[model samples]
Target chain A: MRKFAALLYKDLLLLVRDKAGLLFLFAMPMVLVLVMTGIQDGAVENSSKKTVSVLILDKDRDEMGREIISELQRQDLFDVTLADSTQTASEVQQAVKEGSFLIGVYIPENISSMVRNEIESSLSEMLGLGSTPQTDTLSSLKVFIDPTVNNTFRTTMMCYLREASNHIEKKALLSTISETAQEFSPFPTDSMAPPPDLKPISIDEIAYSKDAFRTNINVTEHNVPAWTLFAIFFIVISLSGGIIKERQDGSFSRLMAMTCPYSTYLMSKIVVYECVCVLQFLLVMMMGKLLFPLVGLPVFSMHGAFALCLMIVFFCALAAIGIGLTLGTFASTHQQASVLGAVTVVVLSAVGGIWVPTFLMPPFLKAVSVLSPLNWGIEAFYNVILRDGGIRSVLPNCLLLLALTVACTAVSIVAKKKI
Target chain B: MATTILRIEKLRKTYPNGNKEVLTGLDLTIGQGEIYGFLGPNGAGKTTTVNILAGLLKQDSGNIEIFGKPVASDRKNTMRRVGFVPQSIAIYPELTAYENLSVFGSVYGISRPELTNRIGKLLDLFGLEKFRDKKAASFSGGMKRSLNLMVGILHNPDLLILDEPTVGIDVQSKVVILEYLKTLNSHGTTILYTSHDMEEAEHLCTRVGIIDGGKLVAADSPEALARRFPECHDLKSVYLELTGKELRTMED
Candidate 1:
């Protein structure tokens, strides 16, 4: 026990002296979070230019069909394409299914005449003179929609299409009434009522959210936790380098030459690196809490965030230290340890959503990202920062990170034996 | 039974890279409190033997007994009573000399109070007391080497092995180290010494073993080996007579 304490103390002393290492471990991540948030927020500012692809299959090919298609094109929200005449409706549906088009609009045959006939009958009935109202009126349009489209985008497209149909119907009715009122009215000419003022459909919006980040979230809410985890795991580099340095300097073998247990020496290194990682995590998170909101980014706090964060920091450090020790034990030189360690961490970070959020990744990549502890960690952070969730929300992620830590430590122990 | 401290019989080791044997059925014995010189050229497996004894590497075949206990592959308990001052500078440069000694002492199971006293006494004995608090990184080569040796002997092991301890130091520093080692021997610490300096070995060693190509060619006192070759009066000439002057630039 005393030897372990001595070993741990000495390791801590050496690590504290490495100023550059500490900076890279803590400050680098904080800076990265800020920089990435700034860039992503700039992107959010120009989000109105986003586009969704729509394919139109106009079998009606009439004045009403052309007008409705023109109105949709005018919205500037869609990259509109008219379907090829060579393809059947089923083929076009297949295209939509394959994600080639976000939505497909198929207008039925004679839809313009059908709409006109319905309008004329309605006018005649109101005048109490002429044919009965048509029972089969064309009011529905066939829309082949991509099921995987964003909910917001799908809602906007559906509303636009509905408004176009309503406009066509209203224009068709008003014309029919103007023509018939002069010729068919039995009431006195002066008593003929002016067309009732058409009231445009209006929407009233109400919001009932009490959560802070429920209304909207910016890049800061995502990046602060993301890059912080990324930065903490990068300790693999310095930790491995330190071990390789010890081996190169012969202190490693000298330590082995003593009567001390290998378990104590190995455990001391693991403990020290874990402590350093936890300390860096706290420092980065504290910076996020103090500095992030000042920059006008969305920020929210959940109760028990501190304890949950500490648990994450510990498991994350353990996992990173495991890799560090494994690489250290196998690497024969400083260059070997540094190069291999850096490559490994960079790859993990890439898949783990440091470069891009796993939610936005392609289906396959997103599925693979689930195996990345960094992705798990980012999700836990998002639960708290965006959903107002607490420790209970992040428990599963913490457990998985712990499992990875154990696995990595096991590999490290095995490798340490060969040395 | 001359109170043997170490016994190696038919020990053999092959390098991990294969195709070569480093130690080939070598045998040696050292009695209590005697300075036994291990003389060999480079790549002659002296360090390999010491490593095996210190539990850093395993022998392919053979047995080693220290104080009647078989030296287990790990040398865990047996190592507590043995010390190895390696050829390289093993002290942590970032640490102060005192800090290095304290840590090493604790590893050998010395209590903190006793370790403190041992550090003070050993530092003063080696003339390192004044520089004890300074970082070892700033020390001269001689000071580093001296501190390296200080760490090994601080535990007061029954058996102390010095692997070319005086390799690259000033004559003054070398004299202090040699004299200190003699004093340790007088106090009943069995010494296993390796050096290229023939004169120093001639003066210090009670018995000598000449090893070449992982095999022992001769074993006796300097005078006795010299008497075998009347033309060789000095230990270096006697060593040359036994091991030859062929340059061993490659592993055997």
Candidate 2:
């Protein structure tokens, strides 16, 4: 035990004395986290959530006009501001043209009456109680938008208005039916109501909105753990490079000359790196889960996130050490160790969904990503950080990481024997 | 009658490729407190012999005993009592002189205070007291060599095996190292030294063995070996007379 502690302490002291290495170890990952998060958030903010502000002019000042604006605001996708009582349709359009809002709309008087009249006449003709209804020439609603506005936005605004008009027609029909039944019976009969098209496609939209919200992934949750683990796993390069230097320069012989079992030396290497890796894990997590809120990202509850992170990071360190030791043992030169170490970590990080989400990857690459250990690690992080998963949710990822550690460490032992 | 410190009988080895044999039925012995010199032409297998004796290599067929412990049966016990100075500098360059000594001493299982004491003593003995805290990376070649030798013997082993410890160094540094070896031998330490410097070997060795083509061609006092060859002026000529005038180069 004394021998083991001495060797471990010596290596750690040597690493700490290297100012450049220490700087990279502590500063590089923090900087990468901030940069990557900023970049990802930039893409997310730009590509999604096209929030539009609308200036609404309600000339009718009726229930139908209020319902349209209320429904738009209820979706939480638009900022709906009512026009002043004195503002005209031209004033609303001018406000939109002057860059006050992305969209402008006017609801003139008698537009609600026109929709109600159309529904009643159509229902009466369908029932053969009157002649075929004449289609009205009066426009019901007029919208003005910036010419630079995209067609998608135009289509979205048209859909909202169409739905709002349909809802008002249904409400007017229901009220007329109730009045007719009040004259004859106690309850409104189904025959008194208008056609089936007046009914909504869905009576309840709350459930849909709840699910639609999940479509937007929080970039911070995904970026924090993915890049943090990516940086931590890169210990393979530094660890392997250090060991290969000692081996090439014949300093390793000094340890062998002392009758110090090579196994003990290998263990000390693992211990020292594990210590460093765990410390790195804590430092990175502090900035990720703790300080993420400063940048408008929600600070996920630390309750279960800590254990999930610790478990995965521990095995990740072990697996990283295993890779480093195996490569250091097999490589005949310092360059071989460094190049192989760097390439392996880089390739693993790419396929493991660190840089790009697997869900967004092409089919074949996504299928092959499962073979990467980093894939399992990043997946485990995603489950806890983004998916609101618990300990049981990440069991498979944790077990895979541990299995990789065992297999890699075993192979490294075999390789070390040749040395 | 000096007690025997190393005894080898019928030791043999061959390369894995089987193109050439490294050691063939070689035999030798060294007594306690003896400064034994090992001499050979190129490819004479002096290094192979030293490697096997130091327990770094396993001999295919042999019985090797160091201080009555069979090296093949008890590798750790024998190696713990042996100190080796490889031809290359093996000390950690990134470590301070004191740190290097402490690392080796601790692994040898020396207690903390004793290891500390030994580091101080060895640093002074090598006249590196002022540079104790300095890293070995910036040290001169001779200072590194001296520190390299110090790390080997820091555990105070009974038998020290030095393989060309003075290959590249200044004359004054070489003299300091040689005088220190003489001092160590006088204090009841057995030394096994291999070098290409014939004059140094002729004066320093109590007994010298010359090997050629994996065979022990000569083993006797330097004066005795020189006397046998009347045509030679010294051990240098005697070495040439015994080994041959032909170059012993192997094809790459």
Candidate 3:
């Protein structure tokens, strides 16, 4: 322990003295989070500010049609445009397909009257009256969505339509029940009776994460973890260079001639660099939390257990340091280590969903992404921050990262012996 | 009658890269308190032999005993009594002179107070006390070399192996280093030093070995070797007489 402490202290001194290394570790990540979050937020804002143009064909032309139109308009994401009475369903579909509108809704003719008749018949049957015969009529709502719209937007649009349908049905059912009770009243009831305010089934759309107010992940939440991981893994460049420097300068040879085990030297380097990675993460996160809001971006809010998030970050740091140690051990010179380390990190970031979301990647790249330790790190972060996942959810990724650390450390140890 | 500090018998090494045979059945031994100068031209296996003695490289086949125990059987314990100063300036450039010595000293399991004292004494002895707080990268070549040497001997090993310890240094630093080596030898520190400078070897070595083509051509006191080659005037002439005047600059 004493010898390890000495080695650790020496490495720390060297790291702090390297001004360029310190800057790369801390400053680079902060700037990346801020700039990337700003850019992504601007894109989000532009897209959201231009509301989706929705065309509605109300063949019902009654209470249900008006209620649906009013409800769709209440949503901030939609721009509801009522179609002319002469326009057909095919015309609305063609308009949406032509990109004139993002979505088109068609309400069947006499749909509100059918709903009122169905509720009244059900109520009369419940009161021991005979059922009334009804004519066959179209009862389904038809919606046409632009194929270019992504699944998330399509799903959100469908959810809002369903909500509107539920609201109108509930309103019609209560009014029918109130009217029926008045006709069959045994006591004299005043005309000032308040309408039933009962809501049998209300559906509220919310983000699945810990924060109920968060309808969806914002730019800050997405970019902060992604860029921070990229910067953390980038510690390889400086760390591998340091290792090669020690070998070329004969410090490694001198140390080998002593009574200490080789593991001591390797451990000292890993411990120091891992600490630097953690510090980099904290610095970037703090910038996202405090500095981002000042720059007109949303604050980076963590939605998972803080302790679990830290554990994932800690494992990620270990994996990054392990790669650094392996690169330094195998590389003959500083240039070789730096170049190979940088390229490896870039490739990892590329396939690991750093530049794009994993789901957005093609099939082959998405399959390959699982092999990257950075991918594991980002997935784990998403699980905690975006999914509000607990230990049970992130345990697999954490274990995989830990396994990578062990494997990489093993390689380094074997290579150092040969050196 | 002196205690044998190091012994090697039938030592052999063949690098697998180009199947190059660097050492072939070489035998040598050094005794306590003897300044044994190992001299060779380029590619004569001087660095390889010293690296093996320092536990930096594994021999293909050899029997090496230091302090009367087999080095292979107890390498860590054997290394505890040995110190090696490599040809390159090996100190951490980003670290202070004191820090370099302290780290290396701690590896030998020295107490903090004792290591500090030893580091201070070494710094004063090497005329590096004033630069103790300065990073090795900022030091002159000679000062860096001095700090490198200090790190090697921070634990006061029983045997010190140095490879070109004074190369690329000023005359003043060279004189001080030579004087210090002599002082260390007088205090019973066995020294195995390798150098190409015949004059420095002739002045400092109690006995010197001249090797060429992976074999020791001659081994004796400088005066005795000169007497043996009566036509030669000094150790350099004796070396030339035994190894020839051909240029030896090829890769070993």
Global lDDT of each candidate = 0.81, 0.80, 0.86
**Fraction of native contacts (fnat) of each candidate:** 0.56, 0.56, 0.85
lDDT (tens digit, per residue) of candidate 2 on B1-252: 599998888889886666888888888889999998999887888888887776556678978889977876777878888989888898778789988888878888889999999888888988999999999988999999999899889888899999989989999889989999999999988999998899999988988989887768898889998888888789999998888888777421
How does chain A of every candidate compare to the true chain A by TM-score?
0.67, 0.67, 0.69
User: Where is model 1 more than 4 Å wrong at Cα?
Assistant: A46-216, A300-304, A387-393
Ranking by DockQ: 3, 1, 2
List DockQ, one per candidate, in order.
Answer: 0.52, 0.47, 0.63
lDDT of 3 by residue, A116-166 (tens): 777777777888767777535639889999888767668877887787777
* 2 versus 3: better lDDT goes to: 3
> Could you give the CAPRI-style class of model 3?
medium
lDDT of 1: 0.81
Ranked by lDDT, the better of candidates 1 and 2 is 1
In terms of lDDT, the poorest run of 10 residues in model 1 chain A is A205-214
Angstrom error at residue B27, model 2: 2.5
Candidate 2 TM-score on chain B = 0.96
Highest lDDT, which number?
A: 3
